[model samples]
Target: MKIMKTVQKVPGGMMVVPLLIGAIINTVAPHALKIGSFTTAVFSSAGVASFVGLQTFFVGTNLKFKEAPEALRRGSVLLVAKYLAGLILAIITNKIFGLSGFLGISVLAIICSVTGSNGSLYLSLMGTYGDSKDTAAQGILNIHDGPFLALITLGASGLASIPLLSLLAAIVPLLVGCILGNADKDLRDFFSPGASIVIPFVGFTIGAGINFSLIIKAGLSGILVGLLVFFVGGGLSILADRYINKRPGYAGAAIASAAGNTIASPAAIAIIDPKYKPFVASATTQIAAAVVLTVIIVPPLVAWMAKRYGCPKFDEQKAKNASLQES
Candidate 1:
């Protein structure tokens, strides 16, 4: 049907299309796909946990130690910048609205939604507009896939306290993947590609768990959160890339979206603190909507920024080198 080709034409179509379809299916006929064991397992929220764990493992396998240094450097700059911006939002929301949340948005939801960046989207944009080091930056940045960042921010902000073990448990899949991928080149080769391949399943699973009605309730707020992340996070990241990394600033803007995995955060937090349970469903839908919103908007914004304000240092150096050769 050329569906994939059509979807590919969109900036984040690979993940967004499946998520939307899954949401529609879940919304229209919640039990229509539960016809069999396999369908029941794959087409429901129960399946999301499994897929996320596996997808995380695959993402981990792509993190080779060889890429660690540059990845850590650039990744940390972007992560800290994005995280702080989110933390500020959390604090503001707390002061203004309190933990119960304001206008259907919880402090936990806002922090969780904004802190996670879409690694695939960032890497895709980096591949198009950046150099090798930029691409490798995903290594450290990818660690935000799960709930650890939100938990940490909550704990640090004194809004919620999490157990030490839960924090460790959050990273187990990533650590395991890194170990396996580093230990065997064959394993890395086999699983690294699966990271991208598994994204559709990730999207579908996230969507399947979401109730579209919740999306309706969180619609405007979700879009607002997405915009906040895209502009504020992008701005913080661009400054870091320019001043901290001393590179073109577009790499920071490239990380402007909420990762699809972040749709799971509120539920994860609810697991730790029952106080958060009431907010989980709505937060999931909100984050899911935010993921779609950012995916649609961030890539083009990054491309435009790169073209207009990209650091000329690298390109100018290439120009000089070319002229010297011509002379």
Candidate 2:
């Protein structure tokens, strides 16, 4: 009961429970189900689940396309900040630190792409910061990490390795959700509940991919890489939020966004470099672990920073609810 309660309290924890179960199954009985490539199956299922979840959430919630402009502006700012941070860092790492392999590039790209949990969670927590316009921006921006990583990998390698089609496959559902969200107010409300269901399955697939053996092999180097990206990438987000936006919560928001790149990077890497499967797999696992850690840690850090900076907290929920009510 206590564990269940704790999971309920945690953002996206219920969704993660299914993922944990899947991982346990893999750990205990690796050969139980030869499900025609676990990664492909899991990813495919996740895509469908996400689509259903988003449709359900948005179907009932009122969405205003008029506010699309505001959402786009904010979303663009955040996306640019995220993209440049990753691209610049990856280049620097490659040029200066001799970290030029696919693993190194993918790791750096992943780091930059990391973004926080969708603004909905923050809105829910902060209660007042709920703006549907902002949430819409957040939703659109949240999904950009995968495409941006793919673009970066393509640019760096001078090879079109990451499958354009695969990236599209991942992106189409989210895009559809956004469109459906704008089309019908009810769609957002309907889709929101399903997010709770879909997220955990995604988490389970991620956990199932984790291999202790690979982590041991990568050892300190991988750990160092992960930490460096988390810290440095996180710092860049802060700077962008502060200097670029002159907003307090923006820093934390940026950090949150940067943290989610784990999901994006591995998928991109798998498509790009099939030969280095283990390296990509290990890097993906490490990135996912980093994302979970950052999600747990960065919000409080951002809250503290916001308090210190005396920046007004944006109540995303209030704004969202207001928008819905107005609509």
Candidate 3:
């Protein structure tokens, strides 16, 4: 029916709608997807990684041979700006709160919230607002996920290395897609639809991993942490994109989201060092709220930024092909 047009009208609807739907299911029944067969395989949390990886390969098909360097620079800008925002959050919170933490939010929450992003959500948002190179930037952003940042920031030692395999998992598929797309232009066009096709499924998979109830569990501080993740972390990332990366701020706004898995960082960090133990539960809760809030918030923020400054799309070839077909 008119569903496609209706969804396209919303800000990041292709991703946000399915994500919210999945969240609703998860919060309500939670086990409905566990009915087995293809239902569980595709709709369950188990499918999130596969969907994300597939989208990455398809997005790579859009990037050409020349834009690779710009993607690296764009990624670097986002990486630095995102991490600096988190580090600043830690320092400011430490100065004002003095380790007791303000409200229910704690150092661990800010550390985890600021240091990285929702890579899957970033890919989804990029599918809407970003160019091929913008999507390629995700390959470099693999550094943001996991407890590595918390461990390093909290001064915990000897846990794990830089996750080389994670880097490879990100880069390899993109490179393969790039080589093939460059070799056959029509193949790029053929596979490009896969990027959008996978968004709803991936969004749903990611949402299945979240529980909106956690926001309530976190209380007012939970909401505050979400706003901080959006304004402090998301805002600065936007600025970096505009000023440093020399583009519209959509990509930066896109990355401000706290990954759903980031909820576990507090406990993981506490495992490494007992000093962070007392704060783990509260921090975990606050981060969980941030994850939910950011998902609900950042897509609209990116959409607004895009509407105001113009969408940062880079599909001139696609545009040209469409024009030729019309003629």
lDDT of candidates 1 onward, in order: 0.73, 0.48, 0.86
Candidate that scores best on TM-score: 3
Going through the candidates in the order shown, the clash numbers are 0, 51, 0
Deviation in Å, model 2, residue 93 alpha carbon = 4.0
lDDT of 3 by residue, 209-312 (tens): 88899989999998988888888888899899999888978899999888777778888888878888898888888888889989888888888888787765
lDDT for model 1 comes to 0.73
- Candidate with more favorable, higher lDDT: 2 or 3: 3
Q: What is the descending lDDT order?
A: 3, 1, 2
Evaluated with lDDT, which candidate comes out highest?
3
- Give me the displacement of residue 213 in model 1, in angstroms: 9.5
Candidate 3 or 2, higher TM-score:
3
**Backbone collision tally, model 1:** 0
- Tens digit of per-residue lDDT, candidate 1, span 1-327: 998899867545666677678878887998876677988788765676576566667756767667567767988899898888788888988998888677777887788878889875675555446654565566567656778789888773354543456546645776788789889999988986665676677667656755556546667878777777787777787888889988768888888888777888888788777888888877787787777677667866776676677533346667999999999
Better of 1 and 3 by TM-score: 3
Off by over 4 Å in 1: 1-68, 156-217, 311-327
List the pairs of residues colliding in candidate 1.
none
